[model samples]
Target: MLNMLGISAGIAVAAYGEARFDAFGVMLQLVTITAEATRLVLIQILLTGATPPPAPAPAQADRDVEMGLLGGESSASRPVMKPQPGS
Candidate 1:
């Protein structure tokens, strides 16, 4: 809301400051800005509504070995040796 107001004020200031203001040219500029804003908004909407691509499935063998889920020895079960007292 604040940004829109700032943009509107800026455009108004620019148009008002023009020494030789042409009504037709000003109108054209306003229309162009409106069209560009609309185009950007539509592009944003389309992009946000778009669906992402499907992810590929893992191999059957790879799936079975996942974290010992199938009752097999998993990498997580490996024992780690602690360092001796001194160094």
Candidate 2:
């Protein structure tokens, strides 16, 4: 809010200081500045408004139940096999 006001004031001052000021040029500058500011504000709103979903604690509980049903042994709990002494 303050930043935009400062930028607009600066442009107005610059335009006032110019001896051969062009109304159309100043109008275009103001329009472009407004558009860019709007774009930035919208982007900030979208980024901060969105949030990721929470962790799946229920899914982990389901997996624990499945492991219990499977004789307390899942593929992940199995030990790796070592190479035989021969062959």
Candidate 3:
């Protein structure tokens, strides 16, 4: 709320300065004021504890592999390979 007020005040001052001085300095001051207000608003939002969206659910294949590993089950019931004496 205070940020909004500050921005409004800055705009009013800039308008007055433009009417009186008609110089580039007033435009620069207005830009600086706008930038500061934006920075303050961002900081206020951060302080208010904004959070990111939740992650997506795991895929079906990934869930199944996880469950199998936890349950001590092999992916396939195949015989173990043995080494030959010579190639």
Candidate 4:
């Protein structure tokens, strides 16, 4: 809600600036308004817990490596070290 209000205020200010200026102020304000609107939309999406679609599944080779990591097998193929005698 606050983000929406901020975006609305920015647009209102931009409109006022455009009306009062005869130079490039209007163009700059338009850019500002657009940026603010974009920010507001992203914020709203985040606050609403919107998530991007899941990525496609990995290839068979990639999945196999990932499984090996989780299955207690190191991908580097290094032998596990044993504990030595304590000091």
Model 4, stretches more than 4 Å misplaced? 1-20, 60-87
Q: What CA root-mean-square deviation does each model show from the true structure?
A: 15.2, 14.8, 15.3, 16.4
- Candidate with top lDDT is 2
Residues 1-87, candidate 4: write the lDDT tens digits.
Answer: 999999999999989966786657667879999999999999999999999998655674576578687885533455777889994
TM-score of 1: 0.36
**TM-score, model 4 to reference:** 0.43
Candidate 1: pairs in clash: none
Give all TM-scores, in the order shown.
0.36, 0.35, 0.35, 0.43
Model 3 poorest 10 in a row by lDDT: 71-80
In the range 14-40, model 2's lDDT, one tens digit per residue, is: 778696778998999999999999999
lDDT of 1: 0.79
For model 3, residues 5-48, the per-residue Cα lDDT tens digits are 99999999889876887558778989999999999989988999
Q: Which stretch of 10 consecutive residues in model 1 shows the poorest summed lDDT?
A: 55-64
What is the alpha-carbon lDDT of model 4 when measured against the actual structure? 0.80
Enumerate clash totals for all models, in the order shown.
0, 0, 0, 0
- Indicate whether candidate 3 or candidate 4 has the larger lDDT: 4
Candidate scoring better on lDDT of 1 and 4: 4
Error of 3 at 12 (Å): 20
Best by TM-score: 4
